[model samples]
Target: METVRQRQQRRQSDAAAHRQRYTNNPQLHKFTLKFSEDTDVGNYFASHRIDVTNSTICNHCNALKLPTESPGMCCSNGKVVLMEPTIPPLLQHLFTSQDDIAKDFHDKIRFYNSAFTFASVGVRFDRELANAKNGIYTFRVQGSFYHRIGLLLPEAGSNPHYLQMYIYDTQHELHHRTNTIPNSNLNPAIVEDIKAILDEVNPYSINFRYISNFPEEDIKNLSMLIHTNIPGLDQRTHNVPTAPQVAAIWINNNVPPGAIQKRDILLRTRMNQLIHISEFSG
Candidate 1:
């Protein structure tokens, strides 16, 4: 005996109920974090001490002192001086840049905190030097890390880039190679050193093939892959309460039991799981 209008209403109600059921299901919430290009480097440097330099240097005998039997040849002065090695400023800059990216998006991306999963891909370009006939270029790339919950909420600061992340080539390699232009060959030693460092850090994950020569299309494709794979990059349906549900819950808690009391309890419980942000909230 129902009319066409009543049938339509019933169908809509069923669809909404199904959606709610799916949103509340815990099995559907698995996700990972990915970083973006704009994450802050300064904060990362401060936290990880990546920019802190440590090195070993040879001990030498001073002019006024004689050398001991330690290793090097003897000197007139008996006293030998110890020299601590120092990292060049250019190398320090590279570590700082990578750290910045990691810190910037740590909170927004949920999976970043789980273990230490991360991935990196970069590009290498060829350019002609000012005075040389050969090509000189550098390789660089940035990776992102973020969680699924971040997509639905605004970041703590108004900075949109605050939620982004990045890592790039070292300044020393870039500047030195670029200065020599065409004459400079791909320094196998330097390349091996970089590779060793990456392996040592063991960032969540890594992809080294996407060097500076990657085309624009390739860049776009890589970017798409990052977005799809990174956790929390896209907004998804969750157990958040609608405006009416929030109002109903508020009212029920403040007043005596009413017609909406049962629904309010369901909404409040769902919101608790989906919208918890206590860590970042003061």
Candidate 2:
């Protein structure tokens, strides 16, 4: 009963609505990966170099794939595929500048001082306690005095990724005992607050310590985190991955045991509590 023009207009309106919903709805965006057999999904994504780890295909989209794996056989039947946003430009800039500073100064006193300022703070993963299955880990470090440090788990590619940085404070200190210099301005409250939040998520058990002199082991771990990405490449290198990419690498490399143990404990405790309440109510 509808005219051709009316049908076209209706389709356009439907598409506009779908786009709006996809962009605004977080739940809709969190769906996992899917794929179809009939289509050449790999070829289609070649230009974009889709990160297999992050990409996902919806059930509807997967249904459209043909049985063949050939390039021409795979075709999109107007099915929508959602893609996650790339790393933020600000993070990319920070990494780029940090890499440049490292190359220019190496390990000179001036370079080390500048590196601390640029990274805003120093952080290290306590490998002795990190575990992947339980998803808990400890971290310790020294940095600008009284600076506000924050740990962030920004949503990325259907998975939440974490980052920690110092938001405030910048100062220097000297260690009188060894006549050595250290970043004395680090804050204890920030570390405790981070641990408290981790306690709730139960992702990892975290312990934080502030020291006048950087712990040798902690410094080693922090160095690994900062230089986890490509050695000499800038933000635009073809093979050089993004900040999220490097963060993923760092997490994969360091899995703490204590953190995992705590995560299991928290998860079981919460689950049991919920079950008890449910039974009583019913």
- The prediction achieving the highest TM-score against the true structure is 2
Which regions of candidate 2 are displaced past 4 Å?
A: 1-76, 83-86, 95-97, 100-276, 279-282
Write one digit per residue (lDDT tens) for candidate 1, span 135-232: 22223222333242222113455221111111222223334322322443333444334444443443422332224234547655221111234557
- Report how far off residue 163 is in candidate 2 (Å): 14
Candidate 2's residue-wise lDDT over 145-189, tens digit each? 332222332123322111221211112111111112245332333
- TM-score of model 2 relative to the true fold? 0.17
Q: Please give the TM-score that candidate 1 achieves against the real structure.
A: 0.14
Q: After TM-score superposition, what is the CA distance of residue 167 in candidate 2 from its true location, in Å?
A: 16
Question: Cα lDDT of model 2 overall?
Answer: 0.36
